[model samples]
Structures are given as C-alpha cells and as structure tokens.
Target chain A: MNLTILIVMAVLTGVLGSPYVTDTDVTPGSDSAGMSAHPNSVPEAADGTEVFHEEGVVEEEGVEEDVMATGELNPSHYPAQRAANVVKHYLNTRYGSPYRWVGLHKVHSANAEEVAESGRKYHLEISVQEMTGNTTEKCSAEVLFPALENQRSPQVQASCEALLTANTTAQEEALYQQYRRNHTLLSGHNLPDSYGHIDPDMKPLWHLGGVASSFVMLKESTENTLYNMAQVANVTQLETENDQLRFNYHVLLHDMVSQEIIHWKLLVTWSPAEGVKVLQMEELPKCEHCEVPPKPN
Target chain B: MKALLILIVLMNLDKNKCFAFLSFSDQVLSITAKTQEQVELLKNVSTQYETVLWQPVSPEYIKEEEPVHLSPSAFAQSFASRFCFRVLLDNTNEMIELQTRNDSTDPRSSSSYYERYHSLEDIYYWINRTTQEHPEMVKVVLIGSSYEKRPLYALKISVGEKQDKKAIWIDCGIHAREWISPAFCMWFSLSYYNQNQDITHILNHMDVYVLPVMNPDGYKYTWTTNRMWRKNRSYSTDSSCVGVDLNRNFDANWCTEGASDKPCSEIYCGAFPESEPESEAVANFLRSHKDSVQLYLTIHSYSQMLLFPYSCTLDEAENHNELLVMAQEAAQKIRRYYRNTYKYGAGGKTIYLAPGGSDDWAYNLGIKYSFTFELQDRGRYGFLLPPSHISKACNEALIAVKTIALRVIEKTQAPQ
Candidate 1:
C-alpha cells in the first residue's frame, strides 16, 4: 500500500503539474502609477468575457515591427499572446494533456531528398470524429460498483448497476492498488499542505466491505477531512456489445471532510480499462554502438 | 639585467631546458642581444602563447534571445479600437478591462514577479464564468497542481456522450518561456467549441483534453525573473539550480541524446528519467488513458513544425509512414496561410534525437498517434509571438490538429 501511494504521488505530480516555488518583492498593484495608468479603464470582464489590457498592446505596437525584422537574430522580440478565453476554457474542462529527444538529425536527413523535390515542408495535425459504425449500451453506477453520485438520473444509475453486475468477478484489488499508487497511500511523505495535509504514516485500521469506492474531502477551516462509507445496497449490470469498457465515480456535498463554505467542489470519475497495467517499470534500451566517448559537447 | 644574467646562467646550467618570462602591464623589448638561435626560439614560444590565447572558447557560447516587439495581442490591447479582435465569440462588448498589476513588468534586481497576464484567481473566475455560460459541452478539470500549488487545468470538449469516446490530448506551455504554447492551447479549446461549431462531431467521437500550461512554475518564472526559463522548478539538493527541462524529463529512451546533464544548462535533464513530478503526472495520466488517447499533441512554439516519435534514436517507428504523411499534410496547411514554412517528420529523422520526450514516450506506450508541434513564424517572432499572429498560428494549428484528428479517427474506424 505504501509503495502504491509513493508511486501514485510520483505519477500524480508528473501528470498534474510540477511544483513552483517563488519569492518576489513586486506586488500586483504596488506600482505608484495606480489604476489610472491607462486612460480607458473598465471593470473586470464578467465570467466568459475576454479581458484585454490596453498598455500591453501599446507596448506590443512599439516593438512588433522591430521584432519582426530582428527577432530571428535576437530571439527576445516575440510577443506574448494572452488568451484568457482559452485558459478559461481549459480551467472549465478536464483531461488534457513534453520531453525532448534526439533522432532529429536522421529524420531530417532522410526527408531532405523528398522535401527538396517537393519544395514543401510537412506538418501533422489530429482531428477526432465520432464514428457511426458501432454503438454501446449506457451503464448505471449503482449496478456497476458500490455507490453512485447523488444527482445521477435513475436510468444512468441503472446502467451502471448493470455494468457492475456483469463484471462481479472484477475484483477491487486492481482498483485499490491503482488508487493507492496514485495517492501514494503508503509513501512516508506527507501530502502537500495544498491538498490538505494527510500524515503518510496514519493508518486507517478498518475493514471497508461492500463499499467498493471512496472519496476524500479536505477540511478547509480545520485540519480534518470527511471519509464516507456505504455498502452496495443494490446493483445491475449492462454489457456493451463493443469490446470497450468505461465507468464513472461521484462526489456529493456530504463528501466534504470539512463543513466550511468553499467556493467549489472537485468530482473525479476514473475508469481504468480492462487488462491495462496500472504501473509498469520498463528497462530503458541502450544503443549498441552508443559508446560513452570523451566528446566535450 | 642581473636577474636575466642569473636566469641565463640557470638555463645554461640546465642546458636542455629553456624558458622566457614576461611581466608587468605592457613591456616590449628586443632580443637582439641574444644569439639568432635563441631569438628564433623565443619568437616561436611567444607565437605559441598567442595562438593559445586566440583559440575561441569551445561549445560555441551562442546566447538565445526572445522576439523584441510586443506580440500582436499586446498591440491590439494598446490600440483597442484599431487592432483589437474579438478574443472570444461570446464576448459582445468592445471594451477590454485592463488589470493594473505590475506583476507583468516589475523587474527587481533580486526577485522575479512571474505572475504576468491575469492572476490565477482571475483565470479561475474567467473559466467558471465561461462554463456557467456554456455548460452544454465545456467541462473543466483541475488536472494537476503546479509547484506553487496553482492548479493545472484541462478543458474537455465533448458533445453528446463521453463514454467510450476516443480522446486527444493537447498540452501547451511546457517551456515556460514559450508563452504562446499556453495561448494556442487555450485558443484551440475556445475555437473548437465556439467558432467551429461543427466540431461537435469531432467532440462527440472524441474527448479533447487541452492543458494550457504544463510548467506553470517555470512559466511564471519566465514572466517574473528570467524571460526564457524552459524547465520546471524542481529543486535538487545537490545543486543550487532549481529547475529541470520538463521536455527532457519524460521516460522515452530516458535521456540519451539532445539533452544536458549540467544543472545550469537550459535543456538540463533531471536527476533521472521522469524525475520531475509534473512530467510524471502527465505521463501517468496519459498511460492510464492510453486506450482512448489516440492522438497525443504536445504544442510548442517559434519553429513551425509537426514532429512525431522515436525521438531517442534513428530507428523508424512502426507507423512511420502514416505519421510522416500526416505531418506533411499539416505542414502544407500551415504554409497556405503565410510564407512561413514548417518542417515535419519523425522526431529523430527530422531534427536532432531528443530522448525522454512525451510524444515519443506516448508512442512507445501504444498511443501511436503522437505529435509534437513547434508553431509560428520560423524564428521571426520566436517565443514572443504577436497577438495578431496568434489567430493565424492558432488557426493554422487548429486546422492541422483537426485534420490529423479526423484522419486518425477515420483510420481507426476503417475496416480493422
């Protein structure tokens, strides 16, 4: 369990984002110029409205031409496109998506002949479209697992129950292992204070039966969170005609570990596909001729 | 003269050896008093020293610089009436509210205020409001948190049912200095749901995940202190340097080439493969969703390129032909907009081999449709792409991404 937690934290940190530590003397509105720096001022945009600053443009105009001419040489002359609209969309959406590698030289070299002949450069973009070929039956949450979101429709709940009933043999060990790894349940390191501190060493010594799922709520006012338990009262299963599998999780107001009034709630529904390995460590391959030479690069 | 005589005596005593010493700020003396043989020998020694001093420092110290002009968006903001374009289709008002925070421009010799653009609070407010307005298709998720505890978010674009849908992942803002990456990522999300309404078909079939900024810490740092930070702020106890090139922190081939081990280097690979938690988080998420995530698009900037996998080595991937074709098609679409050209091909074969790249890693992990896009005007605008071009770059990229997404879906749906 501990190893799983450590692995989960490691993976979570990698997937979610890296930690940022900052110390700065500059205050957002500390400048003596105040809000009057711009002649035209307006209230901040209402939700969904794009907010644009005036001075940033003026500054951009002054340097755009110069940058276009010499930016290649200097590289510092580019502009920053602040698209609040796009960011807003992301903050409202979930599931998204680095790294550098070499093999660039060989690829470029191989394509050089083709590129020269065509006098054209290449690019790759992905466009996903819904398929009309096949269909899958909807599943209900109550039928599939131990619990369901409070607000889910009866029909949807029924579908999930059906999914759970069909897959009774699907043990909860994999799911628990995955969750533990994702959360670093056994890692000795304490959870970051940002997520509401949890002692890595704290052991919850109890048998959680029937209840096949869990939700963690961090207390805002105090250093306490709420953990709710429920037994699977009823369930139904819906088997999909297609080979693909999917599932969803739910979080309710009562799931809050704290009673304080918070601005919002985060509900995550995770569905791990069958036969998928939660965590696998693979050995990195080496180049047969890749020798560690004394090339001072 | 006495010292010279003594030196000569010492030299004679040690007959086989010879040496000449010169000191003080500047002194020019003739060796005419010495024998021709001695003079010639001293001249040779002096020439050797001159050659050594003239040798250029190795590893060619070429410093990188950002585009000098304010980006087009900044231009529009300055002259709102003249250059301003509607950033969002939902924005009916002509006026734009300006945040009066100097966090965008405060340059303290000591501290960096990387919190430029809108603050996190402002960003969240904007997202919340946007979702409230358009709750039908736009679902938001705080995918992860940055080093500073700022939430990393993704906007999911889906129409009808989200179950069993193919997923495409687009992450921007990996190199914090490349501010445009996040912008493009954001812009694409808005455009998909707003301007391009037919995208519902695309969304219905696939859930598109867009992460605007991956390296929030380094990105904030870029705004505040160093304008060119290209890594995540990960502290190494062994060194004072506090960052790792997130791009080089993936596990594809796990740091073999086109990366640096030096902590101070811009492209420094972390202590180990997947050393940075942020990269790990992203990798783990993608791995978990590998079945559905058919297309992995990691957006980057300055160089308009559409790259694919096997970045760690020169070997061609199993789907090399398909990836190359897709890349070529996308590059051509980008060229139609402007004279700007973009290169596309396999990662290793097109450019330098870079190990531990996310795209390559994803490709290796069964997500064959993985791509890394380097967007915009060759190097003209570089990281400081103008706002005006943002639409062009984003539009071109959007077209390309949609094009590839469509292609991949068609291929997937085709007779197996």
Candidate 2:
C-alpha cells in the first residue's frame, strides 16, 4: 500500500511541475517572467519616473488588485504590457486630460519570443476618448516600446515636449492678450479711425482690418458682451522671406450667448515695414469627425 | 402568404441592387484644374469612375484654376494624384447623411423660419399655411405645373394698394441643388410679413412676387433620388437620359454659348427656348406683368456675387452703368452691415458666360434692375450651406436686396 501511494504521488507531481504549469511560482533572477526579474527593474520612485515593478508571485487573485493599485500592468512584467503602459503614460502626461480608456490590443508577431529576447520592439494598439470643447474625440495610437531603458523615457519626454511646444491654444491666448493690451493703449492715445493713420509704434503687432463677417460688435449698453473666444487650431507657414513671413492659421470661434462655433482660415503676412496685414479670412467647411460638446445639465 | 414573402424578398434584392451601384465610400474632391490637360484628365477619370461636377460650367472653365467637385471611387486614386486638388469633403454619402439627418422641422409650430433644410412637401405646406394665415398680404398663385404635375406656386405679397404699385419679381431654386436659394426666398417672405425694418420701404412701395421653388420636380428629386441633380425633370427625346437645365432653357441667347445640347449634360439647354414648362410658365407670367414688374431677382448660391444682365455675351447692357452702380451700392451696404464682400459686375465678366439665364431674359424684357445673386459661401460648402448659416446668409442677402429695390424705386420715380 505504501509503494502504490508513492507512485501515485510521483505521477501527480509530474503532471503539475512543468514550465507550462498554470500555478508555477515566479522564481527570482528569471528573465522570462515576473516584473521584478528584469535587468533594468527599479524601485517605484516618488516622482513617478521609474519603470514599474511588482513584488510576490502573480497569482490569479492578485491580478485585479495589482491592476487597481498600478492603474495598469507594469511594462517589465509582460512583453505587451510595456507598450500599453508607455502609451497611457504618454497621453496622461502630455495632455493632462481626463480620458476614457477604450481599448488596448497586443499585436502578435511570429518572432515575438526572439524580439522579446533581443529586448526590442513591443507593438501595441491603444484607443482613448477625449473631449475638445464640446466634441468627443476618439483617438487611436500605436505604440512601439523601445528596449533600451534610457531611450524609452526620453522618447516619451520628446513626444510630450513636441506637443507642448505646438500648443496653439496657449499661443492664441497670449496673442489675444497682447492684442487687447495694444487696443487699450491705442484707444487711450485717441488715434484716428481712418486707414493709414494707425500709430506707428503699435504697427508691429496689431493693425485695423475689417471685422470678420461672423463676428458682430455689440453695443456696450446692451450687457451682451461680444467676447472673441478664438483658438488657433492649426498653423501653416506659407512663405518666409528676409523681411516678411506669410502664414495661415485655422481659428475656431465660439460665441457665448448664441453658442455658435465656426472654423475659419486666416492668412496673415507680417513684416517690419508693412506691420501685420490680414490678407484673407475664409470660413472652413464643416468636418464630419468634429462634434460640438453637449451642454452640461 | 408565400407570394407576399417572395415579393418582400424581391424588394430587398432590388434595394441591394440599387446600392451596389451607389457606393457610400465615394469621396468628393475639390480640384482646382488650371490647365486644359488637367481638365481633360478629370473628364477621362470621370468616365471610369462615376463623377458629378459641381462648380464652373464645364472642363472648358478650368483655365484660371476654377474649383470643381468630383465624387470619385478609391480606384481613381492614381488618376487623382496627377492633379492639384483639395479634399473639400471626404465622403459624399456622409455629407448627404449629415445634411439630411432629422431635418424635418414643422414650419407651423416654428415661429422663426425653420433653419434646417425642409423637404418639398414641407415647403409646399409652409407656403399654403402662410397664404392661409395672412390672406390679406399673401396670395398663392399657381404659376404652372412641373413635368411630374407638381403645382408650381408663387406667393404675391402686398400689404396695401396693390393696383398701382410696381412689383419686384424674385424667384429661387432655378437649379434644384442650390437649396439655400429657396431657403432665402422663404426667409425673405416671412421676414417681409413680420415687417423687417430693412425691407419695409421696399414692401410698402412695391409688391413682391416670390416663386420659392421653380423646379419642383428637380428639387424633390434631390431630396429623394439624387442629391446632386441640377436640372428640371423633363424627359428628352432620348429615353435613357432626363432633365433640362431651366436656367439655360430661357429665351435670352437660347443655347448659344456655355450651354449644351446633349440630353445627359447638366447644362443641357432644352430643345428650344423656354422648352421646359417651368421656364415657359415663368416667362409667360413675366411677359404678362412686364409693365408692373420693375425689377427681377433670381437667387442661386456658393459664390457671393451680384451679377446683372448680358450673361450670354460680353457686350454690356444699355443700362450697364446704372446696373453696375446700383450693384456696387448694394454690395457696399451689405459689406457695411455684415462685413461680407460681394463681387458685383456684368454676369459674363464677373462670372461665366452662361447664356440663357432668367436675369438676362428679364433684362431683354425691359426689367432694368434684373439681377442674380450667388449667395453666401465662396465655394467652401458649395451648394450645401448648413442650417446654422441660414440666418447670416438671409440677413446679408436681405440687406443687399433692400438696397437694390430701394435704388430701383428711386430710379423709376426720377423724372425723365
């Protein structure tokens, strides 16, 4: 009876002891699996700069708790997890936006094992929902995480930096503030209202052009302020010469009372001699992908 | 029961078959063809992939980089790359879908003019209701019937002493896809009834005749069958093709230049001058009331232009200077009020030489202030101006029309 029991125990152990076993404990210094086993694994930093690492075995019960604690899986834990984490981090840091996580897909490759062994590409597709003004925008981004630890952070940093530099809303707001200051200064000085009579000192930044057709200057006594809520959506530099710079900016204008929004492309040519001249302003056609955000109840 | 089931299945099959030819994936490209070769290439590619040209007369009008809208399939990508173009609208289907979504607004309950595009039936109902509600000022006159026997109605709006007053004849939707044209007419009529201060003098001095939809069948077809159909639904001698461009079927310069004889062409002038019953009926009515009709205004869209007679030729009209001065003044007034620019000149020089225009015909018939307004946009949305823009478009046109009408009244009142 003892011999028979020993044989049965050996058979059971054999069945559950393989590498493909479902409940195998993650061993230390094993590069194949586990978050803490990676060569570049570092402890969690207070500034959220270091790559993520999870302690203990990746048990079935712990997965949900781990996900909740970390917001997402640690990049070093799984080959696909790195890409998704990088993309999420990139969007979160870049826009500082509240977004709905739509989907994350791990792209399969025939040479995935080899690629992971080389510590190179980890391809993933991620989708998120964002709101621009009143419109909800669904954006899909494909991320390919680089293997080098030093390069990874810089890649994300570079992308965020590029987006920050090209932030048109901030630029337009600055320009508008400058315009208002100039307007106040000119009005205070009591300049003439006719063409060619603008103050020479203020000619570099602001000049009098025809008011856009879609905008109406309301009477001050009406208490209905015609606020120029305009944002530069896009800018294209058409020509650059020694003295003059010609550029076109697509601006989105929104009215407070009417709740009317219109997109217009304005061509502007600037030079020291000519000051700033609005060459043309035309309304852009409606876009299918764009939607006005719903009013909050 | 089996027969009914078979009929239902067959109907589904028929619907699927119709959609097989109509691709929802087709894209609308705005090509600025500068050379004859590029224009010819466009025509060639159009043959392979189904295309609908939107602006300018034809391929011949591509000399100065004129904008042309072409709906081409993905297969034409290689052909499209050879030319310089902008994707004005990506998907034609999506555009139509967007324009037609929940567009039904009952004109009765809506105190303000229904800004969204309305169906033909809704427009007709609005017309009938307006006349019925204001029997004193509004009178519905059945001008004629379309080829499909749709009654052509015109509203004669006059508040008081209609006998001796001069009249301003305003017609819209001469080309069916120009939906804003008809919308302007409806808005103008409603605003006049409400005694809009700008047009109050014009209404008090003269009667206004508004034929809101000239080509009813074509307008209905645009809503139902094809969104881009531009002519009246009149069967030609050839049984395969249909429609006659009513603007080109008028008597002035009849089929001379910038018009076609082919039945399949968009600008096909009919078999003879005033061939389409719609045009013939309008011409007959104008002829009968030539003495009282001092000014004729026909509204079309996409180009902000106010053009006067002689669209058939380069030659100036006898009252060219007077018409030019009046149009300039009207444009200036519109600019000052709305800050929108409107180009004004003789039709042939300002726009294209489209021969048989109603304005030209009216000018020939002795209506000195005959003008055509290409309203609102400058070819950005082309024929599809959204409902939100209706107020602006109508307001600007209102200011210009009031200016012209006041000028016409002044010109007529001055002693010879």
Candidate 3:
C-alpha cells in the first residue's frame, strides 16, 4: 500500500477500527434508508457499548422440515379462527407497527393436534397482508394453545417474511404522547380525503385504524376472502384510560376478492407500551352502494 | 514528515488497545446543531473521533429542529456536553466483531475460483477466460474504459445466437467499496455459464447483459490502497478530492438534498452529470439500449434492500405499486430460501431520498423495471462483508434477480 493509503487506513484504524472515518462504503443504517453518500453515519440505536455475537457459520438449514400433510380445515370454524387469532396477536406484539402493520389475511389450511394434558397445537398455512399497503404474503405459522388458555398466552412461531416495519419508536412515542396531551385527538371522516390524500401527520391515525380493523378482518377472514381498510367512514376520540388513548371508529372494509364494501364499528385503545387493542367490533347492517364515502363531520 | 511520523505512531499503536481501554465507551450519540457554530463543532468532532453518523448523514442534512446521529465508538461521556448529546447505542464494536466473526475465506480454497472475491486484475482475467470458455453463450463487449484507461467489460449472455432478444441489463460494483455487488455479478455469470438450467430458462427469454465491474479504477484502488474508496479515479480542475461518486453522477435530479456538490464530499455529483468516464460509459450504454432492455438492475451491498425508482425525490414512481409488489415478491423469495429479511419498496420511501442515482435515471429513460439492490447482512459486516458470505450473499441476490426477471418476462414476453 502507498504511504498515504497506509497512513489514512492507520489513522482510521486507531480512531475506530476499520469501521471509521469517511471512505469505506458501510451502511450502519439499521433502521432508516439512510443515504450512503454521507460518511460517518452509523446506525441510530445500535449503541457502540457491546453486542452479543451469535457464532454460527453461514450455513443453510440443509434438511427441509416437511410438515405432516393433512386435509384443509374450514377457516371460519371457532377452533381454526381462534388459532389464527392467536397468530394476529403474536404478530402485533412482535410488530405493534404502523406502516408494515401485518394482520392475518386468510387461513388457507389448519391442522389441529391435541397434546395430552399440555395444549392443542395448530399448524397453519395462512396469508399475511401489509394493512396500509395492499400486498399480501403467504405465511406458515404454528400456534400452541395451552390447555390452561386464560392463564397463558399462546406460543407462536410464524414465517411471515414479507413485512416492512420501520424502526420509528421514538417518533411513534412522541406522536402518541402528543396525541394524549391534546384535548382533541385526531378524529376524522373519509381520510385520504375527497382528493385521495392524507396529511402526513394524520397518516398514523388511519394506520392505527387499519391495525385495529385487522382484528375484525382477521376474525371474519377465511380462505376465500381478501380484506382491506378502504376508508374511515367516521372516527371519534374517546376518553383516555390508564395512559392508553381510546377511540371509536366507523370504517369501511373492502373485500378485494368479492368487490364488496361493508361497514363496521370498532372500539380501540393504543399506547406505545400496550400496542393496538381492539376492544370491540360490531358489523353494521348491509348498506348497498356504501362506496360513496360519508360526508366529513 | 509530520504525516510520516503520525503514520509510524499509528502503526505502533497496539491493536488490543481497543479491548484494553476501559475509560472509553463506544456509543451512537446525537448532536443537535442550534447554530452554524455547533454544526462546525459537530463536523470537527466527527473528524476527530471518526464517528460513523446514523441520521442526517451530514450537518447539511440536519433540518431546522432535526438532530443528527453519530456513532462515536471511540468517544466517552463528560466530553463536549455543550451539544446536548444523547447516547443512542453502545457496544457497536462488539456487534461489528460478532458480525464478522464468521468471516472465513482462504484464497487457497477450492480451485474453482468463481466463488471467491477476486482482484480487479483477476476479475478482468475471469471476464476474458469465461468469454473464451463459453464462446457460444458469452460474448464480451467493451462498453468503455475507466478514467485510469482500464477497459469496462460487459458480457452479453444468451443461450442461442439471437442478437435482438429483449434483455435484462445488470451492472455491479459501481461503488468500489461494496465488494459484494461485483461478487454477485461474477456468481450470476458463473451460474449461467455452468449450465444452471433455471438461469438458462430465463436467458432463453431475455439476453442478459452483465457489467461485472462498473468502476474499475476505484475497485483497483480499494484492493491496492485504501479499502474504503467509493468513487472513480478521476481528476478535476477545482479540487483535489480525486474522484466523484459515480452513482451520484447520473443525470436524474442531480445533486439534490441526499447528495453533496462539494468535490471533497463523498457524494459530490461531478462537474455535471457524466463527468466521470465510468458513469458516462454506463449512461451511454443504457441509453443506446433503452428500448430493448426491459429491466435494469444495479447491485449494491450491506443494507439488504430491493429498491426501485425514484430515489431522487419523495414522489412515488409512475408504476410505484407494480415495482413495490415485484420488490416485495423478490424479498419474500430471499426470505423463504435464505431465511433473511430484505426490505422492498420505492427507493425514496423505502430507504431515503437519494438523488442522481442510476436506478432513477434508468427508470426515467423508460426502462420501466429498473431496480437497485442493497444486499446481505443488513449492517453487521457492512462493506467488508467477508469471503465466507460470498456464496450466500450472491445466492440471495441471484434469487431476487431471477424472481424479478421472471416477473418481467411474464408481463412483457407472453406468447400471443
């Protein structure tokens, strides 16, 4: 190496190992799609203090585990839908997201196994969709329902690969607190407005509504149905409860597969700590031609 | 003389000093610049500590109230409290170490050298040798030469002797430090030449145009001198920075917010668009073949993302939804096969608003399916991704490439 290159490398090495200075094309943008053009930018949250190194060689799982083949069970049944419901909660806790908020779109097949005195395990093949964006992915998840159901949360291992969640906890937390502090929590109707545009600040509210609606869609969802939160017919802010903000929403759910617009009402509460919780959901009477969004209050 | 003595001192410093030191706390910290003085102070601190910044890459990127993030892995607290800095993360060294711990590569390994990281010379040799070996399948075309007068070689790979097939154009290693990008191109070429039937099926549909190393001069510089050079070996009358960020040298929304115009800056966009020979060559080649090339894929590394236009602005692409779904499907394939996560969406929304990028330029030129892939190990090993990951990273990228190529074919070349 030339003296200049060696000296530059040496100074950088001493400064912060090879992970130093401007020059090397390194992307420590653990969360953001940070522009690489900027030198000296490391990841935001990945502190320099210490990290646990999982020392496994880059080797593929050579043997593919074949799931025992079984007949496809009806997705609308209580047992099947209950297990799928567990998957939805599991996903929310892992994500608790706004953009890449994924919910169970459909349960294609379900196989139930009863464990003596332990629990009932459900092996499921399902589809998960990004609630905000209209992309759905096929996922294989295994959910275990312990015999003592109320006492323990179901353990779930899901292969829901196509999820695009942003690491904006700081922003989300700030937004949540900002909303809580306000006497008027963002309540609106026909968001994306008449012009098909949602103000950037109001996007999180709609995203939350979509996430809350996921619970209803997940419950009513079957192998034949595809659902999306089309529009917020009306949304109203309710009182806060124990640091969680509650809201009442009248929303339209569009079934893409069937091209039908349905109306539903939901009671929801959310906090950064408690994620999104759907307290209640009630389907409204069939309203024909409800695609014409209700006028904003 | 001072530089030489400084070099000597740096050379003598114990490598284990990083481990032995207890006073230092490696942390990702933020410094909010209330004034230009504070911004200048931050720039100085960044230089002194060699901190890797996290957000608002440059002080210029810092908005009115937005704070910038930096990983001062070598800085301790109680120093420079004037800036109101907060610790974002600690233990980045251990993380990076853990990430690279599995990096095992031996040049002496398997005689089949196609699966290894090669020098610029070796890459050139491979291009020649492969062209000779697979005369029927591969034909080497000299796109243009680098600023250092190195020939930029592109291979047109097609199964049968069909000159006018709808094609897929791929260019790799545009940024020299991103070694994995070039490695992908090499792996892709080797796989096709190896009679990988699945790859051949795609070739049967679209003639594959592969530029193995887009910036040869900078790549050679990385191998020989500094391993972090991200630009071409070009010169300008104004400054002595010695190179221009070729990716930023494209004409689309040239040198906007995400890019820097100062020649010394890494993202300096060149005197104008196509100021450097490397970028000029690529632009010319893509422009001439814009009609035939249905998909233009540019490979990059470290941030495992499948990005499409337009990175230049916050505005969505005309076919943004189509591109998003394609990228999503490609990402899913990587996840299912490799068990790794890859973010897929519009470049602007998915990553950040990066102007003058090649993908955006290519897309604007009417290559509807243009994409730029940032490959492998999210941030663990970054640019220095190690030889052991060569096969896995390349394979992961290959999966994404094939998925998108098949999708384009299904959309475009359907039988009547």
Model 1 chain B: weakest 10-residue lDDT segment is B87-96
**Residues B71-96 of candidate 1: C-alpha lDDT, one tens digit per residue:** 11111212222211111100110011
Those runs of model 3 whose alpha carbons end farther than 4 Å from true positions after fitting are: A1-297, B1-112
Highest lDDT, which number? 3
lDDT tens digits, residues A186-260, model 1? 222111111112222221111111011211211111111222221111122112223322122111111111111
Please tell me the interface RMSD, in Å, for model 3. Answer: 20.1
Evaluate residue B321 in candidate 3 and report its C-alpha lDDT on the 0 to 100 scale.
80
- CAPRI verdict on model 3? incorrect
**What lDDT does candidate 2 reach at residue B229?**
59
- Candidate order, TM-score descending: 3, 2, 1
Candidate 3 lDDT over B1-416, as tens digits, reads 33345334433432211111212223344456778777776766665654555565454565434566665533433344565554333223323322222234443443124445778887888789888988988899999999999999999988886668899999999988788888889878866753332465688889999999999998987676545567888888987667888988999999887777887666778899988888989999998998899999999875567888988986878998888789888876665545555656666654455788899999999999999998865322345554545655676688788889889998998773
Error of 3 at B237 (Å): 0.8
